[model samples]
Target: MFLFKRPLISALFRRKIQYPKSLNIKPLITFQINKMSTTVTIPEKQSVIYYDKTGGPEVLQFSTDFPVPSDLASNEILVKNRYSGINYIETYFRNGIYPASFPYIPGREASGEIVAIGSDVKNFKIGDKIAYLGNQNFAQFTKLDSNKVSIINVGANATDDQLKLYAASLLQGLTAITLINEAYNVKEGDYILVTAAAGGVGLILVQLLSKIKKAHVIAVASTNEKLNKAKVNGAEFLLNSSELSYDQIADKILEITNGKGADGIFDSIGKDSFEMDMKSIKRKGTIVSFGNASGAVSPLSITRLSPKNVKIARPQLFGYVTEPEEFQFYTESLFDLIKNGDLKIDIYKVYALKDYKTATIEMEGRKTSGKILLEIPN
Candidate 1:
């Protein structure tokens, strides 16, 4: 539960918006999971994008008669969503590449307001603005464990729209944060290469690695426009992944690093980028294959690492944020950076929740940049 008590509620609910004057941020107040009764307004059934079988986006069927939970677990909170983020990973679930149960609601992350809370819920109350990344969040209202949600403090300075952007965008930002800070700690002056640098997580990685960690970031994208967008986000160098072959890109990276090669490579574009990732890093450097945007990287012999002491890691978002401490650290750190203006959220397109199929099409086609959002109708 770990919900904040009344004394800390003022901090979470600011009356006036003012930016913190300095980066000397205070630690978040700690609270235990406690239970309390709360009254809420709700409906018995709601519309949702559901699927009875795994397939493509075509399999998704919108229905209005889906039964809403009649009871909340003591540790649960109910959210009426305003927006949900669309990630490529959902396509994996929709396609049966990732195992899922039938009649599934296919969404992983959303931003909304708490409309109800179970008796044991203590920190969050009805009408509190919040956001969560979890399963079955594609519906109009989704129930979540109190521990698995974040309070979107609409400080006097941040508007509801701004907080909604934070909610829709945090998942990718957190992924990038985990990639750089935890999976492979990027150091000052480190030459790091990021694939799909104009894409959601890649764009965030470019900004954070270059601006926050002081790393030299090289961006790989599909077009000149995306490359320029990455440049604006602090990418020092660029390579059009579509224009050049992987081998050529690897060679260019080596040339950029003055033959020493990149100190580290954060690759989300797997498959075609796999061998290049191995070839592009310096001796003893690490290559993290965090996603399969270009499809899964086929199995490689462990002996490949023996050549130049190259290391490859495949880290997942769920694995990194499994611990409560780590989860809070990453999510809060991301929000702090946003509030401090160290990171920016670029939402390239917004679609109605009913247009999810089109959103997935654009996302999968790599036709959009930054983040794509689905505005859940009230």
Candidate 2:
């Protein structure tokens, strides 16, 4: 029995929430074979999306029968992925929105049926359908720790088919976990504004803040589709991201609070909504700036925060997960919320695994609402 000690919770959560860790030649999951092929004439290849050169979606190409290692480890679960989800961070890494080493796999989330399990594995069994958060999901198959993937966290008992919608957004839940636990110490009836409310993180954050944190949520999005999604999830007020300037948005936010600004603003769009987040909040409000979809945020000084007796902080999963105590606290808390139906995952699109190029383009162009998935071929 591989008891999940509290110390290794981050490794387990990677199987559920975030992508694979830094590849420091570490294969927590490895494969083994009894009689290995010596000739090596035909490579054990896994079809993957890669770019020989970085430019755009056109640069991404797929190759079949890519060399897949046969060495096996006991606790790792090998999944013949049925579906994988896409996210913006993957896009940032792909479009060079953030720098990365070239010739890398592009996607972050996927769900697949477990095809094989190592000898030491427990909890998950062979042939169970599962989804996980990780890198190299662009490949046809990958290994994951059994402790990390959950069986019914999202699909069957999930409310109204919308539960399945958020399976790929395990990463979104991850970031939301950190923000809820670390930054604000949010309380019931606290008002919050989730910018990019229709986006990967904002959509999930809306529900978590409302249902779990017991806070009132205001959603800020760029489109009708997004607004509806956010509202359906739990947002009490929806503001058009495209129509509102900082002052205009601020006015609407204050109006929603009856002239009181929100207690918290979850702004992932960075500069586009930075000042608005500051202006749209009550005294001592906490503004959490995590991503840079619009652009990166520069430093903020104590002087700027002193006027309202407020605070500004950047929230990331890595910051919380680095500490085992915090890691266990967050992962357990988020899953508990999901189990109780407080936080819902919304996946707007499901593409065939072969449709990698199409999915990436849609995600990059912001064409989809919640999470996008790649259904792997069995």
lDDT against the true structure, per candidate, is 0.77, 0.66
- 1-378: candidate 2 lDDT, tens digit per residue: 011222333332232334223312222223332222121132366777766565778888887756664554665666665566676666566667677786677666665555666666644455555545666777777766544433222222223233234346556777876676566667788899888888878888887777666789999888878899888888999888677776798999888899879998888888778888878879978888887877677677769888888888886666665543433445555565655666667667778767888887877676778767776654
Task: Give Cα distance to truth, residue 282, candidate 2, Å.
Answer: 2.7
Q: What would you estimate as the lDDT of candidate 1?
A: 0.77
What's the count of clashing pairs in each model shown?
4, 22
- Tens digits of per-residue lDDT, candidate 1, 1-378, equal 112221221222232212233223333322344453456657788878888887766788888788876577767778887788888788878787678888889788887777777666666667777666777777788887775534443333435686567665778988987787667877789999999999889889999889888889999999999999999999999999789999999999999999988989999888989889888899999999988777789988999899889877899887876655455556666776776688898889888878888888888888999988888777
Model 2 worst lDDT run, 10 consecutive residues: 33-42
Maximum-lDDT candidate? 1
> What's the TM-score of every candidate structure?
0.87, 0.75
Q: List where candidate 1 sits over 4 angstroms from the true fold.
A: 1-40, 149-158
